[model samples]
Target chain A: MKDKDGVSGVDSSSSGVNRRDFLKVGATAAAVAGASSVGMAESATAASFNPKKFAGTTVKILLVDGERDQEGIKDKISYIQKTHGIKVEVTALALGAQLEKIQSVLHAPTSEYDIIDNLGFTVSGVVGGGLFTKLNDYIANKELTASTYNYPADFPAGQLDYTSRYDVAKNKFGGKDVYLIPGMHSGSVIMFYRKDLLAAAGIPVPKNWDDYIDAARKLNTGGVSGTTMIAANDVSLILVDWYARFASMGGKLMSGTPGAKNYKPNLNGATAVRAVQHMIDCAEVSPKGVGSFGFTESVDAFSRGDVALMLCWSTIAGSAFNPATSKVASKIGAVQIPGDANTSGRPIRGGWGLGIPKNLPQKRKDAAWMVMQYITSAEFDKYQFDKYQTDPNRRGTYVDAALNKKYPYLKVAGQAMENAKMLDVALIPECFELVGEAAREFNLAIIGSQTAKQACANAQASWEKILKRAGHLA
Target chain B: MLYSLGISFFEFDRVAGKWNFLGLGNYKEILSDKVFWSSILVTGVMVGVALIVEVVAGVSLAIFFGQKLKGSKFVRAILITPMILNPVVVGLMWRALLNPQWGLINWFIGLFGIDNPPIWLADPKWTLWTLIFVDIWQWTPFIFVVVFARYQALPMDVFESARVDGASPLKIIRYITLPLVSSAVVFAAIFRGIDSFRTFDLVYGLTFGGPGRSTTTLSFYSFENGFVYYRYGFASALSYIMVIMATIGFSVLLKWIPVRRNH
Candidate 1:
């Protein structure tokens, strides 16, 4: 085929045109055309890109172990070394601690790992701090091929939106090409309850805020707390849950567009105030120490059969129903979070992604990109689901017969994904701290120290202050 | 001296690398922050309350153990056990013990005919006090050990002289014993005060400055702003404020300790 620029080809028959010169020119033209046609693809077959053959070279990765994907770090390292010829060192850190560690490392020039598994929020920090290599050139140069890369398409639109940068001028994402790959996506705030208990109480599983309140009140009657949620001073979990419930109630934390540094506070409106009030009411029926409880306390309360319902992550369903982990496992059941007046059928999405750190050497980055491709591939998603019970983030993986049988809950979780909204706080990093602080103030009101109105007012004031300090106030 | 010593370094170049020197602009921003002021007030209250509790209980325990009583040695060792355990471990253990649902404290409350026990850590009004309890439980013994050792080292003649003067036990304690041990008390308070101001591991491990920022001290606030939120400049400003507050506290404490007198 002729090049788009219509450059003339060398004469093959002329004796003046050496065979070698003709071949080199022909190859160079073909290469340039190929690179332009499909960005980030090298002229190599997927079958030949064997990561296992690069054994002597070691790569370090940081990942969080979700409930479903609790792969033993040793086994993963060993398999990568044996199969791909590369020695992989994986450090599986807890969710919160990992965020802290990533923030500290990214702030400095040199990073501890060749690759870091970061969420969209952390990726924003990495981007803002110029910590990650811009993949636009690499993608355009065909150094990273999407066909061989196997980027999962099953991640919800919100998850994709969260990870990809928004070019305000273009009003499009993934337009600048990929910066981070959606590693794993799961629903952040899922409403779970003891199915048996709800049935026994003659109350149906709640489908909306009114029903939820009624069910909680009924559950609170039998010496059991109505619902368990993270209300402690740690704002990340609390705000995620708050946003989930608020979205269900037709409220939003902020308005404008993603990656816009100057967004207005849409959370202090009437809808937001009502959402805060509902949470305060829920707190009344919660366990005695609900305000002080973090993730562990909330989960423990639900798992121990002391609480009738819990609004948490989809990853928590397995733990809540595991006999070893929960006393109420046999009676527990999972469902979508109840909707509020505004949002009658929306679930919140909370999970992280994999991105190339800017500080990595070019060769190391190439290697790291390969690893990300391998893990996020269709074959790997199957392996992850079958071996570890981790649900895949790809659409095809959700319908895979084998995965459905092994983890029936994934079907429900997958359904929740269709209605998933990215927890608003994750988009703005400072919002996490602000929301957490606001939630604590709300908790103070819930426990009767502060009135519900007072709590809302305090939260609005606090949130406004944070936005002002971040130069985002409208 | 500053140039020769690598330890006494500042990131002047890094600071000047990007932004203009606002000359304490960040500090000005911090001073104007209500959260900053609130954090300062919280830390002050926590330190003051914790110190007072530690001193009273510590002094009493030291005086009690100073007496020659049966099983006093065993009690002393048991009381000091909390200090030996890691602060994180101690925090977790107490969290379990004070847990509203399954904790022993709540279980005992049930025995008292109470329907629902107050969630010690969960209640905003009670959260700070709960942290205080944990701090006192862990560190009161340090004070006890110090005060007890000093009490034992007091010359026997001083008490004998008070006794010969027909002084009552209360009078002897107030006039003689108290004055002699005042130096040791000052030293312990200074050390403990500084340590308490920087307390992170135990409080973080226990409450994480939660139930609505009721338990957040200056250090916790600094951590949240710096690492969690990635506001390095703001965090640096908070750190400097902490340093100033600590320095002032130390200076005021040192004034009470007699530099010339060897106790």
Candidate 2:
């Protein structure tokens, strides 16, 4: 149904369920319905739900636009609007500013964002604060399906696991059932190298920790700096990368046992100590004045051909490959970061998701889920890779012939994805700050300002104190 | 009366609705926080050092330009130009200048036979002082303009009377000029002190309180905790503490120096 003002006329009955009733009914229905509906809805929607036929529906999506996805999707906005008769409004914000805006909006009871992109930092908080709708019901009820959505299969299993939480200790639905759907699978901190430079230096592409050191040394002799990583306040990205490597080294940041909130400083353990020493060794070979490098500085240095290698996100891959933005574009090659002996087989994974705001009307929540499902469908995964150069999170997309042909490096990313490990840190609300503080001390240690033992000890002490304040530490 | 009533109402709304009223809880946390205390020490050092440099340099420039010379007006205009630029812009300009790899400062330092110039903003120990240097460069112009105006407005007769008494130029300046402009000096100190306490834009743009929190000031800490970390209650507590400190500092300065009247 469509109103004169262009708002979709959702059934009034859908709005009657209160918060308590929905919580009681939603979880039970979701679990039972999810298994049966996986293959049920493919034909029902594909035959009838035509975007061109549906008119007068407006969808508001909040997105961070500075990255490749936003730039790639901007051109398609008009096409989607014209075809579907759906008016889509995208609000582009700086990454940090977007987080603050979303948090402030979520904190207010009557806030009005229908759909929001979910950063890893805000996912737990948003869910715990009851600011997001659980999508398990929609997925289970067959209201949303793989055909209707774009990225349903593009997501990696690990990403899906991270997005979904189990309240195993309490044997509950964890307050919400899968609050987010992985929209863009662009999270791995890939290492970008100058292929030409490596060839000139007669060095092989680094595969493991030892290879990485040897390559760095070879690159250093040619007047080219070894590698660059973010060490600034926004060093959370790099810290996550380091955690992935530590996990590869068989060092767990926290025990995965459910119900246990307090975590010990396993970072001081042998595996973690070795990993930190490896990072310190890498730091010594990094360019002069690497201590103050943030995401922008590190990326700029790599793109400008000032550094031999940059350990950063796949999200920046498109920019690094563009001839206009990068001086070393044609010479650049992608590879998974080298893991330690224990983690040599694993790769690090990082990315964000899309979810409905819990405060919206039930009809709006359903509509938002409809939009999310459509955007993450198989078709859209191809569209994203073709247009935006974003890596799909799904295993199938890794082997897509079209994708492989257009972006040969997707194979490298796929290999990294196969070995990808999640950050072994706690997913609690204060985890970001705790990780940031620890990373700062770790960076200090890497730059020779503090010893590895001293850095880990100091980080443990600081983290213990922070966790104590948050009631997570005994 | 109206203004007082409005302020009271605003204060009531803020206390009742905005703040969580954790009372001593946040204060206790701040007291025990090593990061908080370390930031306080850093802020104190920065403000103290920058203030001394700004006042001394600013006053000297003010006195220098107070003398009549050809193109004096043009020189005065150029000297006060930095006061009009935004703090963020000033910071970015200086960050570019101080960049170790490509910076003009490092380039200039290389010409002086110093082969290895220190990474000014990248090193933990030098970041705070480097930020202070940028602040002094930008805000000292404000002080110079204010003090120069004060110098221009000084009575010609008082200096003439001092000169008739056989007082040297230095003596006349020390006794007559300095005493008359004491309020202006106090004004500059108090204003600069209050502004420096809340300084964020420049420091944020330049150092981002980094190289391991070496340049993190109290205001920057408050912003990070409140906005970045989403600890609204703790941030509110920090703001209140800053307010009390600023009020006390201003009150003492006001009491110490009475405003000059046009007798």
Candidate 1 per-residue C-alpha lDDT over B17-36 given as tens digits, one digit per residue, 9 for 90 to 100: 24334456667777888778
Q: What TM-score does chain B alone reach in each candidate, compared with the true chain B?
A: 0.88, 0.88
DockQ of each: 0.44, 0.37
In candidate 1, stretches whose alpha carbon ends up further than 4 angstroms from where it belongs are A1-46, A64-71, A92-96, A134-149, A154-157, A164-176, A236-238, A257-262, A340-342, A377-391, A425-429, B1-21, B68-70, B151-180, B257-263
**Across residues A1-474, which tens digit of lDDT does each residue of candidate 2 receive?**
222532112122321222233233334433323322242223444544433333466677777655655654466667666545566667767676788888766657754566787665445556555567767667665334443342233345556655544232232223335777776545566677898988888886675667777788678755678877665545553354466457656676765332364555565777667777777787777777776676667788888887887677676565677666778778888765655543343445566777787677665665566556656555555567666667765544555655666566665565455445555443566666787777778777766788878877877787777766655566
C-alpha-based local distance difference test score of model 1 = 0.65
Q: Per model, state how many residue pairs clash.
A: 20, 16
Q: What RMSD, rounded to one decimal, does every model reach?
A: 11.5, 10.3
Best candidate (score: DockQ): 1
Return the TM-score for each candidate structure. Answer: 0.83, 0.83
